[model samples]
Target chain A: MDIAYFPGCSLHAMAHEYDTSTRLVCQRLGINLYEVPDWNCCGATAAHSLDHHLSVGLSSRNLALVKDMNLKQMTTPCAGCFNRLKTASVELKQNDDLTAEIEKLAGISLTGAKEVEVAHTLQVIMEAVGMEGIKEQVIKPLNGMKLAAYSGCLITRPRAIAQFDDPEQPVALDHLLQALGAQPVHWSHKAECCGGGFAASDTDIVVDLGGQVLEAARQAGAEAIVAACPMCQTNLDTRQRAIEDERGIKYNLPIVYFTQLMGLAFSYSPRQMGLNRLLTSPTTLLRSRGLS
Target chain B: MSADFYKPMRLNEIDSSLQEEIKKVCDINVELCMECGKCTGGCSNAHIFDYTPRKIVQLVKLGAEKTLLSMDALWTCVSCQLCVDRCPSQINIPHIMDYIREKAHRQGVKTRRINVELFHDLMLNSIRKTGRVAEAPLMLNFNLRSRQYMKDAVLGGRMFLKGKLSPFSPVVKDIDHVRRLFKKIADNREG
Candidate 1:
């Protein structure tokens, strides 16, 4: 199966490991990911916060590029990019005024833009490779390693835009973990916000909210937290020490991308999955489980 | 309840222009709200917000545009969309928050959380310049502009060691197309 992929800005830089693992895992799953050529930034929180039209227009340009690619579907690894692109696709199809304005701004005729469907990479994996299919490819079972499936906010949010999984209680990640032979622990902060896009702007918000997420996962007896979004992984992993320092509690939980875990289950080496890139190293935890 | 809760509010005297504007722009009817605090209850940042989602809707109904635009909630809202999804009426509080925040930005209203706005501007500036955001340089510029050079310094070192921080910024081949969109938005806002 071939799908247009938009790695977004984070995947190229701060979340390079996510990009590497996503490509490797998708290759193993027999999914061909054709990157959308010359795709621009999705304008994320900044565009949406200041100018709604610009936000839609920025994403519309990318959607137009996907339309040009002649691909019916486009998928992104970043939840923030997925939200923006999906929102733009939904809005342009429904609101003719927006479609017209975006065409004028983007200087491209979005004739078949509505035909392009935007989905998160997780949705792609779940739909293209079913639970049974994933179970069949598990060369190395997770050895009952407990994990907290952290969906963050944008993956399955607002109910209308994402249009996949439950916004309140998302279980797709949990189900995927189960298929990988990992024990997905019941956690309260599964779909909670990780203070996204605020890690640079306001560090305190991430520390406060991310602290709660970490504490919830730790309380649920999760050996590690599996995240699908780069922002969530970055916030939870990088600021963990700060969160510990502020809350005066020890939480040495490593935040790993779900793709990384899938790669591990596919018998890929830790270095192949870029596991060493994680701030809170999962080496000790994985070694304990004998899965690494 | 506070004694102010019992104070009779003259419905005829209250200006509903803000609510009217929201409906006009986003088609979200704040009047459809039944005063259910479920939005605030599930809100991710309500504890940190000066005006919760429920209160922001009420402010719109009362035509408290000044307060709505200048409130710290405008800057602090995480846009998690929990409030909108949980609302029985499905009032898009995040959309309203975005609309009001944009208005505040256009008017140059003084935000208590200046760094938040500054970071946003820097990100936009990066996109406008290169058609894509370079995380490494963007973070550097944010730290420099916010005057906290030491912020995220340790994390930066770790990321650099992990080969995450790329020194070269990625630029789109068709940069003119992206800039035109930014210029058009600016022109529209001005006109």
Candidate 2:
């Protein structure tokens, strides 16, 4: 199946691995991701809080761009971008007056644009790609590997917007892990917030609050935490050091996007999954078990 | 846990017009509070607040505006959306807390440290100027405001090196269009 893709800003910059690996994995899964030409920033958390209309306007511009491309479904790898795009789509659909107002503001009509569907990279993999297909492609199944899934607030929350899974306790990632032949650790803080942009804007809160999710994952016996969003990956992976210092506890959990795990399951090499970008490498762990 | 554990600040003890505005906006149904302690149990920051979420909601239900105004619990919410997410009665407890905090600001109840107020000023100032946030200015302004000017020095400098974080705020094309819409919202809200 073919879908329009909007990678958003972070995927190009910080989460390049997610972008590349998703593309490669999608190719392996017989899915085509055509970029929405001239796509702009999704206005993420910044625009949403400051100017409500501008946030919707920015996201609508991208949605309209995808609609203009004649693709009804636009897949975004970043959870935050997906949330912003999906929420804006719902808002525009529900409030026509506001939609018209925003369309006029942008000088483009969203009238008759195909109903654009926004979904994360995971939804396409689990639902569209199918577990049986993944099981067939597993050159290296992560057998007996205990992993925890950490889905921060952006992907699951504001449940009215992204109705992909149960917001309170989602098992999409865990189910995907099992399909790849890995054990998913059970934990309660799956839908918790990793302080979002607060990690960059506010260090103290990130340390205190981000630590809670990490501890929950660790206590649940997860060797590594798997995530789909770039921000969540950066927070849990990049900021693990700060959390350890602040809390005086060693949490050497590896943060891997589900695509990287999928890449491995598809029999693709770690290099192809961009596994080298990880702060905590899964090479030693995967190799120790002769899987890598 | 203990009876004396929660000591709410008395609103009547502190007279402030800002508090009155807060009370007006919150419009919390003070009488409906069951003191069931659900909000307190679900709150992520109950440990930080002298008054738990249940106490705050109860205070609002009781029209204990002044006491609610002075409590630190009003500012502690991270806006995680969990309290409202789990509220069986579906109370918008966090929005009420934000409203109360805005009132506290008008009444000169502020963070003892300028560091935390840095975010408030940056977010509001950015919104006030553009009716939209410009990420470049927001981060630069935050760094300047918080005196963490050196914190993002290497990384931000690298971003500048890569031509990412430009020195100027990004102008969303035809921002006047958005300004007018914001004006309409303001007008309707006032009406």
Candidate 3:
């Protein structure tokens, strides 16, 4: 199960924990992740917001690199990057004019680029390592830790671009948590927005929307929130205290990456999964469940 | 409140160029929208948007270019795609938002939320320089430029202690390729 990996910008810096856990879990699952060499940023919300051609061109450059790696599939841990790369790959394959334009703008030949498939890291794990396969490797079950599976936007969004899982009501993360012996609570804001790129530009939006997600997770009695996207994890974890201060309520729920939980279930240490990097600590919750 | 509220719009005089442009650029037909408020109902940021998703679509059909380009919704939209997914006609409001936003940016329309566009520009400048975004430096510059210097100072210190803030920025091996792509796109947009 060899696949090309694009950790994106956040994985290298803010979401380094996601990168660590993803690599560790993938290795344990016998999945070889060959990183796309010298990949550029996916342009994210910026490029797409300002210029559509630049957005497609940026991801097309990475797609071209994947073809050069001779890999048929690529996976990214960041949902934003996955969305941009997947959208580019889909558009490049479907629209000849787009392929030609992207080739001209990016200076990369898309001769066999149509063969390259883009998928989120969660999709890779679910497809390559099935529920039975994951359960077989769970040396340390979650001990019934209640978790809110926060798929966030971009992972299962726009339907046409992501092309995996339900956009409105995603359950892949919940199913994965169930395979790990964790109880995934039913929450309203599971697939809601966490103000994404607005975290830096406008803090109010994150405070408002992220507050809704945290409140929903807490109301559902989740011990912790599980996230697959770096932005969502960052927003929910970092801005939680601010949200609490604003709403006059306390939500001490830690936002953990799905990969981190998978690593824990696979008997990896908390340090190995970079669990301490989270702002809202999950140590207490994990300890209470006797799974730390 | 005003006489304009009771005045009927001259349907034949309404401009359709913006609608045509949207169809040409995004391949989304504004006319397909049945004025269902499902988009606004499920919108994550509709509460903050000056013009809701349904109204934005209506404005597109009405060819309200000035309103569409200058609305605060252009800056506040989270691009969650919930509106498009929930739309009976799949109008792609997010894409429409993007198209209008890009146009607004090009026209240099005054954004109601200036910091949002500023942050985006800063991120793009970082990419233009390093071929990748350096989160630590980018955030610092954003704080400095946006005059919100103390915005995340506490979080920064905590993250720094945890070794989350890397000082070194990542530069791609072949930087010229990225610069060339950026230059070409800018030139294309201008020409």
Clashes per candidate, residues 3 or more apart or on different chains: 0, 5, 0
Score residue A27 of candidate 1 by CA lDDT: 90
Q: Write the per-residue lDDT of candidate 2 for residues A1-292, one digit (tens) a residue.
A: 9999988766765577888888998998888999987666666655554345666777787788887888899899888888789878988887778788787666678864428888887888778867787787887888778998877775666566677777678888888889899999889888887767665566666677779989999899988889989888877766787789888999888889989888887777887787876776788877865667
Which residue segments of model 1 deviate by more than 4 Å? B1-8
The docking quality of candidate 1, as DockQ, is: 0.85
Candidate 2 stretches greater than 4 Å from native: A112-114, B1-40, B49-76, B91-145, B152-191
Ranking by DockQ: 1, 3, 2
Candidate 2 CAPRI category:
incorrect
Task: For candidate 1, write residues B107-188 as lDDT tens digits.
Answer: 9999889999999999999999999999989999999988998998888999899888887788999999999999988888
TM-score of predicted model 3?
Answer: 0.98
Worst 10 residues of 1 chain A by lDDT: A105-114
Model 3 regions lying over 4 Å from their true place: B1-7
The DockQ figures for the candidates are: 0.85, 0.16, 0.84
Q: What is the lDDT of candidate 3?
A: 0.91
lDDT of 3 at A124: 88
Give the higher-DockQ candidate: 1 or 2: 1
Residue A242 of model 2, lDDT score: 77
